[model samples]
Target: MQSCSSALCVLILLITTVTTSSGSASLSVTVKLNDSATLPCSERCSGLVTWTVSHKPTDVLAECDQTSCRSVKEGYQMIHDQYLKGNLSLTITDADFTKRDWYTCTCNNKDICDVALQLEPLRSSVQMKPGETLVLDLDVSDPVEVIYNSRANGSSGHICIVDRGSLECTVEYAQRASLTSALELKGVTPSDSGVYTIQVTRTEEVIHVYTVTIQDDLPHPDRDQETVVPVWGIILLILLVVLMGGCFCNVVVLQRRRNIMQRWRKTDGQRKKEKKKEKWLSLT
Candidate 1:
């Protein structure tokens, strides 16, 4: 009979522990980068109400009493009027990647609200010509991996990893890639066209995905300049042809003048010789 009574008491204690230990999931918030976020807790607080990191219970983030409210850290606050009523929402100004975590609210040391805060996943597209540099923002200080998914062959692989401010890429990208808060690929080619994903290395949670399209190779600027004929060069060639034509015309005119002079001299000599012969015949 005593054993049965003890068992009943134990079961009752377990039921009570389960019910009181869990705070009601009052809110789930997802905000964009640098956006404001409100973690809500709808519970009346007659005494001191405190908000803290769920994992770090002793570190209070915000607290409110009947008279006023205070935020223990920057970028976080609890309103006075809301606490007087039934709302204990903590607002984070300029929410970012570093602020994503689970938070808990307590009123008089009893759990009242549990909130899960997260940032919206980033997605964007980019178009790049071959031989141009492709830059992608890492957007996070924590360690992460950049993955490539080829659109041509439907293959996928990791391009690089950023950890502890160091970046390491695969053998294919080692020579042409660099990372300093952003990933840069120099002299990109059509073969580099694909999707890039930035994910948390530890959790494999995707933070951002980029669709990159590398267009066909462009003509080299130096080569194009070499092939193009300059306007000044064409003008000089035209002038040379004109000068040669003028020289030919002058030579023809000089030859005609010389021929006329020679013909006149020969005719005068013939007339003179005839006169002399006539005189000699008259004398005879």
Candidate 2:
């Protein structure tokens, strides 16, 4: 009998551990937007479990209903409860910027347990060189998508679609300008120089934005060269040199013809022979 009781106690302990590990009474909360959060409620105990929010050991904000609870704490108001089959999520309506604080999620049927709620920041910063490519390094999260907006100077920017998993943005602009990834400019001129802002969004909430500037000056050129000219330009230059040489050769040929004609008119073959005989007699 003693052995049987000991075995039964061990079995009960194992069962409790398995229940806790296998999503029996687990809770996860994600705070985003003004007053929106998702709370994973207990799946084992099927009954009305109350959810509560506490800022610290002392500041308690709300209590849950059969589904979930929404209430006003300080200035922020909880909007609705998405009490699905197992989820006890709360959407806080009219989220206040000043109410950025820690909130604890507690669930109670008979025994009360709490889980920590955390908020993910939506603001992002990026550095880009003028005329250089823009590569975005995104924060790690699932099903998170980012939207890009590009602008130059003080003008309006453009929006673009980005892969949720791809964390890079590359665009070429002719002139220096601040462009938004959300906005793409073909010829970024010097006047386009300024801040380029890229706003990243996941679902409907704006998650992050990256800002970069394009300059009018070519960034890093070869020491002895400006921007790289196309091969066709070099070929054209060679053709122009060849044409100029041909024109010079034609002018030289015309000048030689004129000299020969003048020499022939100045003296005939008979005059040339007479002059030669006079020179020979003087020598004798």
Candidate 3:
């Protein structure tokens, strides 16, 4: 009978412990963004915890802690837990609207806790031609990420390219920082022409768009050949006179030679003398 009584007490204690631990979710955190955001959990029960982010309760934007965070998973990013600083807060290096969503924090053998967030709007500036260099012109309070070449999906905006794996765009942009974000491209081309938007996220979000157009370099016409000379100009008149004088001199020289040749061919001395006199007369 004493043994049965001890067994009943042990069963009751186990039942109470199970009931106390069930549905014990933490009620904390209204919004999170930019830097690391903490979602408080029962530290004692926080073993093998997982943090996941979803937009409109459908699209998972990012996941952190001991699980799969595939970039292939639509709008998903696996954040580094060390970056979070153990605040249970999601550390968004470059916080973006596309990343805004409901993040659920689950503790091993414990209830899940969640927080709602709205990432501010953001954009990129400097629309440029394909293969043309583009200098990033922007100012913002919050950190921003300039992504290219990778399959990076942001809630606010994205840079679209013709080819997926072209490293040209990668080398041109994608420098992230806390205070400033800038990028420069080398030799933009026609395919690079597009709507570039500048995205800034702080307490308030702002975006700016710029239209870019690249004109083809035109060949210059030959200036020396294009210049025209007037027909009645002094220079033209002088050229004509000189040409005529040359022709007249050629005619006179030809006639004198013919007469001299005829005189030499004459067999009689008297006839040759007569021919030479004719030649002199012709010249006179």
Candidate 4:
């Protein structure tokens, strides 16, 4: 009876170990947008291998066996040549935010592994002046939560939460923000400049991240002085042209008068000479 009890305890321990190992087998991987993600499954099982999204387990993504491998969903594939060697890993081409989720791989109707695919959030940088408005554009299809972290003020918190059909903003600044297409923050000051993170709660992943820098409204040089100088220069140029034209007209008039005076004097002299010749002929 002592030996039998000991055997039963060992059997129970073995079953517990197997259950623990199966439950604890999981992987987390991060991939960038439009890049490829490889879900590793190193099990060398000849049974039917299937991959499915954990959220929707009924939807089969892909399935493979010893004979051939095929994709049940677009953009998902398994390397057929590697299947014989027991590498049942799946390669998803052009990964996007829609593909970010928990993936489960099964062999012969048994869960072999779980892969959590986390996509790196899209990043954008913006610079704006004080009192200007900033906009954040997100490309997620599902609902999301927006978080704001200000480096200048050392403040960090949630700005809003968007549901499938409703949009609600919690912060005062975001309350005035637009919800038509993007998040808009108005009257931004230098203290408002910092990183803004947008997370999708459905996938529990950040989908968009933005780094913003706000600058002081620097006092620009008075353009009135610069503008006045050009106006005065143009006015002075017009006055100088008028003065030169007047002087040229006066000189031309004087030259014409002098010529008229010379012609009158020559005509008088000619008349006097003709009269003197007439008197000399009469006397002869």
Residue pairs in clash, model 4: none
Q: lDDT per residue, candidate 3, 1-284, as tens digits?
A: 99999999999999999976664454434233344444444333324445555223334334454442334344334344542444444444444444454566555523356665453333434433345556654443344333332212322334422122221233233331111134455566654455555544232233334444444552223644457566678688999999999999999999999989888776477887899999999999
Give all candidates' CA lDDT scores: 0.89, 0.48, 0.48, 0.84
Task: Give the runs in model 3 whose Cα sits over 4 Å from its true position.
Answer: 1-42, 54-87, 120-284
How does model 4 fare in lDDT? 0.84
Superior by TM-score: candidate 1 or candidate 3 = 1
Q: What is the TM-score of each candidate against the true structure?
A: 0.66, 0.30, 0.25, 0.68
Q: Give the clashing pairs for model 1.
A: none
Question: Model 3, residue 272: displacement in angstroms?
Answer: 70
Ranking by TM-score: 4, 1, 2, 3
lDDT of 4 by residue, 1-284 (tens): 99999999999999999888877269888988899999888887788998899878779888889899999999999977888898989889878877878899888878888999878779999887787778887677688888889897788988888777467887576456767677777888888889999888665677889999888754434654555667788999999999999999999999999999999999999999999999999999
As for TM-score, the candidate ahead, 1 or 4, is: 4
Task: Return the top candidate by TM-score.
Answer: 4
Candidate 4 TM-score to native: 0.68
After TM-score superposition, the amount by which residue 261's alpha carbon in candidate 4 deviates from its true location, in angstroms, is 30
